[model samples]
Target: MGVRYLFQIGDQIVYPMHGAGIIESIEDKEIQGKVHQYYVLQLPNKMQVMLPVGKIKNFSIRKVVDTLTLENVLHLFHNGETDRTLNFKERYKSNMEKMKTGKIQEGAEVLRDLMRMNKEKTLNSSEKSMLGNARKFLSSELGLINGITEDQAIDLLNYRIGK
Candidate 1:
């Protein structure tokens, strides 16, 4: 029998460290003589990942944001002050923790703060890379949101950068 799943095919979701994607299908597979259910997720960048259905809880997988929620999340870009007092190492650690949550809001905060910091002074190699990954996460989910076209999503990702 197939395992119960909270998400169905075509459901948009975020996979921590992997960015956002659509659930392409559910299938059963046997490994080491044991059967396991897996969710085949198709990422926005055309990459695909198959994760065990039973392991999603441990992995922090979650659904994409809704329109209203997205609006509020994006507001971080235009308003609010970033935590600039923390040293670079401390700030990076905090952002890394936020990224691990796989939550859209947290990802947006990371993106917003990092982008603002980048504006103040160029980030180091590691942070520049982190900023890029945050963009990938936030933009991919933004594009998956209802009424948001891919182009519009890209625009949203770039919105505060120009300010």
Candidate 2:
């Protein structure tokens, strides 16, 4: 619990299992007779999460990718191949893990793969849900980094995938 704070108020960060968020505040809260520092993040979904400062690294909390990394992720959409051999359950689990990493590239891959699969055949309920979630994750980050609307980001991704 001696780790120094890595993020400051107003910094943009990604919380694994969630999408892009901004650090709103750093506060000390007393619980069980111990004082703990927490990072309050306001997510793109408008939901807020308070995370313990000591556990941020363990939870994979990280800053949003820079422009170069964003460009690389966009490039991935154009050339990434879908692994269609995996069964539904296997693919779902794998994709879920990737999404949980909260990396822009991984989210883009999941979105691209699911879109390709959807084109080949109708996706089941689970896949359909994952597709929506992946899209949200990708678009949220894209919108934040590129200063565009989420709808615009979704259009950009679809256009890239179609290319």
Candidate 3:
């Protein structure tokens, strides 16, 4: 296997469970008698996430969306034409995986799907948590990419979904 480095220092990236995290530094550290280079990431809001250089690929860390694709995400959310399911656990799990891939558009799709589902009924606690996670992921990345506030990004998402 080969080591894969997807981001450089000073680049903004999104973590699966965490929101926006900036690559703070790249340094070589001795861990268990082996020297390893790692990408130090600081989550402005999370404040405590650190990732190794080689782990980026394994962890599925990735860059944000370009303008056109992000616009498509907005369209997907607004149109409400994607697939939906009534099973909360199944949907949540699928969304979690999408978020873990570090793809902004995929995360947006998950959010849109979940939000549509939520509109149909009262969400349970677990489903609510999943919704929150999806919201957090979308808001952070969308805000940074669009140069908007997190609140504004969330509002845009809600507005597009007509919620």
Which TM-score value belongs to model 2?
Answer: 0.90
Shift in Å, residue 80, candidate 2: 1.0
Quote each prediction's TM-score: 0.90, 0.90, 0.82
Q: Which parts of model 2 are misplaced by more than 4 Å? A: 1-3
lDDT (tens digit, per residue) of candidate 2 on 89-141: 89999999998888788888888899888888899998999999888787777
**lDDT (CA) per prediction:** 0.84, 0.84, 0.76
**What stretches of model 1 exceed 4 Å from their correct place?**
1-3, 146-152, 160-163
Poorest lDDT segment (10 consecutive residues) of candidate 1: 145-154
Which lDDT tens digits does candidate 1 get at residues 7-86? 89989889997788899999889999999999999987789999888887899998887878988876755686788789
Better structure of 1 and 3 per lDDT: 1
Q: Worst lDDT window (10 residues) for model 3?
A: 80-89
Candidate 3 lDDT: 0.76
Clashes of each: 0, 0, 0
